[model samples]
Target: MAENAANLTATLQVKPSIFEIIAQKSLNDILQPAFRKLAEVLATNFPKRFAWLNNYCEESFVVINWLLQYNYLKNYDSTFSENFYGFKRMCVDGKSLSNHHIELSLLFIVLVPYFKRKFDKKVTLYMIEEADGYFKQASILGTNLRRKM
Candidate 1:
């Protein structure tokens, strides 16, 4: 009986079915309440710092997202990663800041963690849904955010 069972098992090939994951998310969807609370915290605690940020009507977080979404962002990303993981400097163009650039920097510094958090959640969800999928996407984001940053 044991031998028969073993023979039957051998006769039947067994493997988990591979599933293709296709997820859709809109560009607008990701921006929900983005870095807004962080900006508020900065305003409340360190009121003097970036005081103009609150007054400035233009959504600075939008610019940071824009930078992350920038087609030329690779120009900055490689420098950031090289500086972070391997070596020498944050050799970023924004380092050569004009007064206006300082505002953009402030926006970036505050919003980066928020963006990282958002991405981390997606990465986990992606890993859960597909350990390594051929078509993992943040969908309509128009960029492979994980691949980029």
Candidate 2:
């Protein structure tokens, strides 16, 4: 699966500040709230996305570092892969940050396990629904920003 998917790539041009802005805004306005709401609905005090933001910063790229500072995010890495994996590939491939693709991808890495643990496989639809909204917003914003440029 990985090998087959590796051949596909898309390129867009956006400034790092766009990534910083989205990361900060999404964490405060979207991701953190989502985590809190999920935990509330699930009736469990699972670790919040805010707590995991710092770990996401570690060994990360320049964009994530900017996000870390912008959001004032700090926390130990969650129990998962040792390094932020997909991000490195994204940077290496020269994709722009105007799109929330990287941010959403990382969020999935963090949230998927929580869903599996809390609601088991049933959380699949919920995750998809939630992500669709964020993805659409990102696509629109990216398109407008690129058009303006």
Candidate 3:
């Protein structure tokens, strides 16, 4: 009975995982208004490139929240690809991630992938156009050659 009590205490004191931290709706509630404003900023500053975010902000956030809830995804380093973000659990011992860091991480992890995974042709076209334009500019400068597929 004492061992059971000790185990329960240990479990209770265990640190929350990054997923658990991100899943806290309190942080979401505090930061989402700012995030919505960020959405506006993206739409305003890069109207041609990111204007589609305005149409899908709420839905995109819903998807992000859903992804942050899964335990299995917490440890996944590749394939799903959270490694692109700043905060890894191993590096964060005895420290806390700033709200800004977490917010950007969520944006990269979800928003970037959301565009492609939806398989929306329009999104694909936009990316292709941007890539082509960028590569063309680079080729003109002799920095790199654009290979034709």
Over the stretch 86-149, how does candidate 3's per-residue lDDT look in tens digits? 2233325545444454555556555655555556768888999999999888888889564678
As for candidate 3, its clashing pairs are none
Which tens-of-lDDT digit does each residue in 54-146 have in candidate 2? 443222223443354223212212211212211222334565332355455455544453445457545877889888988798898875424
For candidate 2, the TM-score is 0.23
Query: What lDDT does the true structure give each of the candidates?
Result: 0.48, 0.43, 0.57
Every model: Cα RMSD to truth: 22.7, 20.2, 13.8
At residue 56, give the lDDT of candidate 3. Answer: 78
lDDT of 1 by residue, 36-146 (tens): 666766777888996656554235765665565332233433222222332222335645334454445434643665567668989999887784453455454455646
Off by over 4 Å in 2: 1-87, 91-93, 96-99, 121-149
TM-score of each: 0.29, 0.23, 0.32
Q: Which is superior by lDDT, 1 or 3?
A: 3
Model 2, global lDDT: 0.43
Error at 22, model 1, angstroms: 9.5
lDDT of 3: 0.57
Better of 2 and 3 by TM-score: 3
Native RMSD of candidate 3 (Å): 13.8
